[model samples]
Target: MKIAFPYMGTSHIAFKMLIRDLGHEPMVPPKLSKKTLTYGTQHSPEFACLPFKILLGSYLEAIEQGAELIITSGGSGPCRAGYYGVLHQKILQDLGYDTKIIVMESPYRNPFDFLGKIKSVISCSGVSWWTFIKVFYKAWEKLKLLDETEFLSHQIRPFECLRGETTKVFKECLNVIDESQTTEQIREARKLTQELLNNISQDHTRKVLKIGIIGEIYVVLEPFANHDLEVTLGEMGVLTHRSIYLSDWTRESTGYESKKNIIKAASPYINELFGGHGIYSVGHTVLYSQKGFDGVVQLAPFTCIPEIVAKTILAKVSNDFAIPVLTVFLDEQTGKAGLQTRLEAFVDLLGQKRAIQEGVVT
Candidate 1:
């Protein structure tokens, strides 16, 4: 089958490798761009969230490129992600596209169901268990390395002595990482990435603001979807930390229930789950406050109930903890100019608050 899937950050790279290992021709979607959003918004319901639209756009494009099957990660929760596959399939049918949708949905309630799905996807003839393990781990390791590179880049970009140098190196590094074809190449890419980033001269003596980014996983991870928020924050001299990484999410999918620590940390603020990553968002906000972060920013797709709930509750967390919170909703129509202006204002507000606390200016 000519299989395809929507890009969710760098996870597409890993999934592409996985599909090839599973004996399918992987049709990776084009990178999210204005054109992708345009196609998505044209067909998507006006009220649907940005991800739904963007992914719809991606699927359509992939089908046009000869992808006959779609593979998407799914969730079973209060969030609509659990139903996206079926709904998206129906939408495609209504639109006259007969592409098959193969959802790798997470059945959180049943381990056997989840395993069965995994087994079904990975069960390819003429592939030995060793070969399967080798390919899978290679892809998985690349995912973690990609996350690390991004995490480190976000940390150093704000303090780099040269403007734009850090981002330049990071982008170049990603390209090299993408070109990596073997485990050895991947390892070398990791090393080269770090060396390049470390060479970006940094002035650590400068007082740089630290901000935590917590939000719906899609918008938080997909920089284009959020208007390159981390890059913008870095350019504004603020170090940014993402609350979740694809590797972290994948680890949980391995049956480890990886969010236990974040859940425990966030227990005081949010005791229960609302599906999606709502609990993680809440817990991450509190954790950020405790870590002396200057502020927190939450990015969500328009009409995402989980993040909307998290945004509402963050008000109390903000007041009780004295940390400012910025909530942003991203869509095809989100204006960059307005978003930049608000970001500037939020940074200024955080700067002023920091000044008062540290007696820099009274």
Candidate 2:
């Protein structure tokens, strides 16, 4: 099968390589464009959420490019993400597209469900189990490594004045991995990527007020969806940490069980505060506050239930910890200028609050 993966932040880079290793042709949609958003918004139900619309556009484009299968993540929880595959499948079918939609559901509660979904896809493509396992393992490792690189890159993006250097390093690392099949080669690429990241200088004296951004994966990771908010915040001398990195999600799945044991030891209330889709997000915010981050900024697409739930709980956490929290809800009609105005206001408020707390603006 000629598989296509939608462009959703750094994840796409790993997915593209995964498809190739699986002996399938991988097609990546063009970088997020105005046309993409426009078409998505026009075709999708008005309140479906921003990420879904953008992905719809990406799938349509990939189908046009001869992709017979479209692969995306699936979820099982209170989060609307659980239904994206079905929704998109219906939309595409309604539009007369014959592409098969492959959803790799997260193996959170039901390992059997995850296995079943993968088996369905592999059976459809007639891929052998041995080959599938081999490629899947390699693909998982690549994704883990890519997520690590992206997390480090985000840590530096706020401090770097130029974007090209970090992006260039990421691309180089991907190229190195794509060309290499051995574990030794993958380890070497990791080392080189780490060294490149450490070499990037940080602005320690700039007083970049730290903000925690939490939200749905797509809106938080995609620059186009958020209007380059991370870059914009960095330009305004504010350090921002987004909570939706691939590594975080990966850990949430694989290591969450053990990690929960540790965090629970520290504070049971912390675990209880975030009940569902945002359990990790709320936990991370408390962690960040303890680390002295100035504030928390939560961004979610309008009608995102999990994030909304997260926001409500975070409000209590923020108040209890005295950490200011700002929540921004986004939708198709959200304008760039409006977003900038809100961001500027948010920064100003955080700055003033910080100054008063530190006696810098008496």
Candidate 3:
């Protein structure tokens, strides 16, 4: 099938690889733009989260580009993301588009659910269910590894100050991996990219404020949605770390139950305070705090319930643990200037907090 997938930050890179590996022509929608967001917001229900609206724009664009199938994921939760694919399908249909919508639902609930969907999308004659499972697992491993590496590179990018060299290398690495290349080749590419990044002149003497960004995946990873906050923060001499990369979500899918059990065993207080997915965010926040990060920044798209819950718990965690926290809520109207101003103020506050902690301020 000539399939298309919407851009959801870095995950789109991995999705492109998965689509190629499955022998489908994957059309990636152009990067998020004003027109894209406007189109999405106009078509989607007002109450839908920002990521859904932005993604809808992507699908609308892709369908116009001769795509026969629209590929998206399914979630199961109180979160609206679970229903996004269905909602987008209905919306597109109402708009007179007749593209096939392929939603890869979570198999954790019913393996048959996913298998049936895949069968409907791709007609494979007499292919055993086990064969499909093996292929899916292998694709998932590649996706998770690529996602984790990209996330790590993002965390390291802002501190490098290499005038976009880090960003360039990161983009090149994605393109290299998407070419159906060997795993060993991809590893070598990553090593060369890292070496190039390390060769850049970075100031180690500067006392940069360390900040952690935690929130919904799309908003945290999409440069357009967040107005390139990481770059802006880096330029302001603030070292930033983010939670909610693709690998993190993939791990949650594979071992969420066990991980949750362990977290509950280790930190019952956290589990009780932040129920459901928020517990994972809380656990990560606590880990970041213990690592001596100067502050924490909680980011969320407007009306994201999971992140809202996580934000509240993180506020308490920050207060109790003596870490400064800044919560930024993003919506269609979120302005770049406003975001930069808030980030600057947050960085300044962190610097003051650090100075006081180190007795640099008397």
Query: In the order shown, what is each candidate's alpha-carbon RMSD?
Result: 1.8, 3.3, 2.9
lDDT of 2 at 76: 63
Clashes of each: 0, 0, 0
Candidate 1: list runs displaced more than 4 Å.
115-125
Answer with 1 or 2, whichever has the higher lDDT: 1
Best TM-score among the predictions, by candidate number: 1
lDDT of 3 by residue, 1-362 (tens): 67898776666766665566566777888777888888899998989888888889888888878898887877766677877888888998899989978787667878888778877654533445565566566566557656755665655665675666666766766666565344565566566655655665665766778778777777887877777777777667777787666666666775553455436532734545333255666676777778899887777888888888878777778777788778888999756888878888888888888888899997
**2 or 3: which has the higher lDDT?**
2
Candidate 3, residue 221: Cα displacement in angstroms equals: 2.6
- Model 2 off-target regions past 4 Å? 123-128, 161-182, 201-203, 254-276
Worst 10 residues of 3 by lDDT: 268-277
- Top lDDT hit: 1
* Candidate 1 residue-wise lDDT, 1-362, digit = tens: 78898888777777787778778898988777778889888888888888888899999899889998898888767998888888899999999999988777555667676667656666644566677778889998889889999899999989988888888998898888888878999999999999989888999998989999999988888877999899998988999999889898877876655678788877887788997889888889888999999999999998899999888889998998898999998878756998999999999999999999999898
Worst 10 residues of 1 by lDDT: 117-126
Q: Count clashing residue pairs in model 2.
A: 0
